[model samples]
Target: MSETILEELFIKRSQQKRKASPLNYKERWFVLTQDKLSYYDYDLNKAKRKSLRGFVELEKIKCVETVQPEPNSPPERSYAFQVIYDEGPLYVFAKNDATRGEWIKKLKEKVRFNKDLIQKYHPCFWADGMWQCCQQQVKEAVGCKVLEHKNGVGFSSKNSSRRRPSRKPLPPTPEEEKPGCRPLPPQPPEEPSHSVGMTVIAEYGYTPVTPQDLELRKDEEYTILEMTDANWWKARDNTGREGYIPSNYVVNAGNGLERFDWYCKNMNRSQAENLLRTENKDGGFLVRDSSKAGKYTVSVFTKGGGESSGNSRHYNICTTQQGQFYLAEKHYFNSIPDLINYHQHNAAGMVSRLKYMVSNRAQPPSTAGLGYGIWEIDPLHLKTIRELGNGQFGVVKYGTWMGQHDVAIKMIKEGSMSEDDFIEEAKIMMKLRHENLVQLYGVCTKQRPIYIVTEFLCNGCLLTYLREGQTQHPTTIQLLEMCKDVTEGMAYLESQQYIHRDLAARNCLVDANGTVKVTDFGLSRYVLDDEYTSSAGSKFPIRWSPPEVLLFCRFSSKSDVWAYGVLMWEVYTMGSLPYQRLNNTEIADQVPRGLRLYRPQLANERIYSIMNRCWHDKPDERPTFQELVVIVQDLLYELQ
Candidate 1:
């Protein structure tokens, strides 16, 4: 009973001029004031004041009830209710049964308070300061109309006590005996002349105020009535109801089933990014057209877990103006296949890759039967020599497996990953075999401390080896040979569509024989497509990343080629760091503006040309790993 009303809303009401006129449901804005219930036509410009259509003083209302279709009512007016008053019943039809019930509930609450104010209230309609319902039309009239009715009833309390007989008993409650509530008749056929032959392409629900709007359920046909804009359309549903819906929600049915590429065209960059982030949260990606013509944007989403907890990041796979695809904007690739190949060797910077393997939940083909040279070593026979290094997934220790084989045992920390996740990673590792790639012996899954056993390189990581061996001063021929070893391993991986995301010299291991082998599958993912985007904010080796990787978090094999250029610089300089004078932040800022590492003093012109090709701004401009292997071999031959 507060004086102020609660809320106002827009609704459609069936208005009729006479008893025989057809019911026309028009949109109106309804407002409940302190003393009355009123409605007005909604103006197209909301800033303008509303013109009142009609109103009823609260004092005149007696009760309200959900009404059945009457003999005189239109067939489509089945969903309706009536407001009982002393003057007459005001009938209102809603779009649906649920709406009818809501109106009845609100009207019932107002009627209870109306009885108290009836004695002092008079029913009057005002327009131009006169009672429009009772006044005669006159030129230049500006005052109140005649106050008395033709029957001699004046607008005063002298005859206010007079009461009329009740029309009928109030409608029964749900528990009472029911009668005469027949089902409504079927609706008339829809008009066919307005058909424009469009159909709903995706499911969409109606959310606006008007009931004339139709819900665009999936596969439903809707003919276009008008094109509101590039994004919206006024369309008519099969039931003949017309309203505005997003244009993208409907399309030409004759186009047949849509392709994955079609669904992503013309989408906003942020919207596509959000879709990949939400839909592929566990680990997935999206491919869509880019802002650049004839190029596409690939989004790779990775969920962070284990040692890199809360390190989720998103990596975009896109081509620059020069047409090179990249991952995390660091690694560049000649093709999407080259980028995906790199991901197969690196999984550190993003979420799991289980989803990217296939469209279903089935695990990747088991490696149990594959002859990948996986050897099962007994944990008791393995002696822990010492800790080598720590990783996101586990800790690496130099150990002897089976009391004889020199091996690096990567013991996965407890709770770092689920048993299934570890098994999946191990299976992917077992399938890969190459001379320059580290060979996996096997995994220990039954014990508390799970171990991934692999061959041990006596000289340790290439970066550490280079730094420690600086005094030895390896010749140009020897450095080029090392570069060839890495390029060969990467070429093999590229052939398998495996991307080595963390492909710096640090991740490469050198054996006692001066051979460099690609190691560390911690940041690798097996991608079916050419690109894999990392989740947003995932940590990456910024120093090794290229301009695109640093700026946009894109990764690809061409990006690895960019890193290879840095690694080649590392070799000729005898382990000097790329961008030695600048920190990571400064390097990230300077690399995109054409700043590159200075040529190494010992690197001859031919060798420097090979490294320079790998640093091309456009990924496609970079030589493939296979081409680099050929170039490096020829350079080494010339020295020999």
Candidate 2:
């Protein structure tokens, strides 16, 4: 390749000699180069001891005290070559001398490119002689003590891996046998480390959970908790009172058991907003015009579902050019409980609660069975929905599902995700279902490029709504209600054993009736019920992230709580950006340093107390979403 690489090889060789252990011993030789591209080799043992005796005796040659000693001071050494240029340090591993010498003349005359010689010279971990002879030969020939070596020859570990396959047939590829470029064949006998487990997790609680700590260790028996991201509502114990703890930290008491999701009600409304106005570069108010807010109202529902004929009234609080207030249907709440009930009844042969039913239980429809009805779609025709947003992954288009219903279609970018990642996302979505949580529909992989379909909220994201100004000035009661809604969603998700890697206001949607729905599980992570450290970071966006997420990239639901604390600031400011005083890097730096944004507007005694706890430096110190829900609900009711 380049001469620079070759020169570096020699330097590397010299460095190796210096680093070699056991300082005193015989058989030591060094290649030294002077200016003029000529080099010299000195065998320390062979040199006349007398010639070096005087200099050695004085032990002062390295300093300026030498009145130059003669015979003994200057040791006899063999010349290898002289350096041509004084360009760099005349150190070992320099280029081979180019001086006109016997060896040089012969090398220039018969330059037959030798592949065998190159292989011999090349560094390898498992070559013959364990690279010792090759290393010595190169050192002597080059007359430069380069340090770096690819000493792979004769490595026992390399030999053990090439055993014959006993089970699965080969993939029918000859080139796969190549030594250097071969992929390690799958071997079941090796160990269980190669196996991967798939799982899904939900979000909940005040403290955010993280995925890095969820690795299942083969050594220890792990118990899978029923609730992924659960919460416990109680009073703080500081005054000997029970306090709320996010259900995530509650591990299974029994070993090797899988836990189930915990069910709870009356989730808190005082919740953290996920959007970070300061961090998002492309952020702006899309709902600036109040009068034009009602133009779009899109809803998605499964085909043949009842309750469809009405043009559901929608409302928008966006600012408009004409300053006219037009209300459009922000959301459509269709009932699927009946169909769910029908399926469950057929499968289990029991009239169970329709709300908790699934379609798999339904057997082939019988003549006497109740049939599922179509609510409002014209199956004969197809229609396109509105475009919601765009990002690096792909564009988000609202599309019609089955018929009259609409859904958000997240067209993933080509090359942005691999099949493995998609599978992982799918595994997480299958088990997570909650009112506050975003619902993931079936994926469209029938085509070459796959797209993810999800429930579409008629009203735009909370980010847009907040920018339009408050529909009603958030009285203590209203703020508490919002917080409760958020906590309820988080608590549900957390109990399901999931970590919402990215939590922001932009992901939360509100209907015209003020009903809130959390969306976007693309960054969700499952916390395996085991003792393992989870790495957390703002892999997607850095501004809204907590300190540990930025530095160590490790987080638990506790870290999520830190982010929630910042979100609390956003909600109180009527959607003010967190850490508005600092830049992105500054905010990121401050987070790990245990610095958090303090908002004066949200300094109400109750709200401030909770936000402070949420942003605690020690993740364990953060309040659980369930506890937060209880506190907010109490505050709201008191104000009411």
Name the candidate that leads on TM-score.
2
lDDT of 2 by residue, 1-640 (tens): 1111011112211212333433221222222111112223334466622221100111111111001111232222122221111111112221333322433333222222210111112122111223232332222121111112112122232333533323333222212023543222211122112111212122222221122123221122223322322222122222332223332323333321112221111222221111112212111111111111112211111212333331111112222222222222231222222222233233232212112211111111011000011112232332456677874456888777546345667776666555445544563453355656655655666554566666666677766666676445655655546556677677666544345656677768775435466766434332222322222222435766765667766655556666667666667777776676777678777777777666457457667767776776655445556445545544553453
lDDT of 1 by residue, 518-571 (tens): 986434433212232221113666667777788776776678888888888888
Q: lDDT per model, in order?
A: 0.56, 0.38
Could you tell me the lDDT of residue 261 within candidate 1? 26
RMSD of 2: 29.8
TM-score between candidate 1 and the true structure: 0.40
Query: What TM-score goes with each of the models?
Result: 0.40, 0.40
Query: Total clashing residue pairs per candidate?
Result: 47, 120
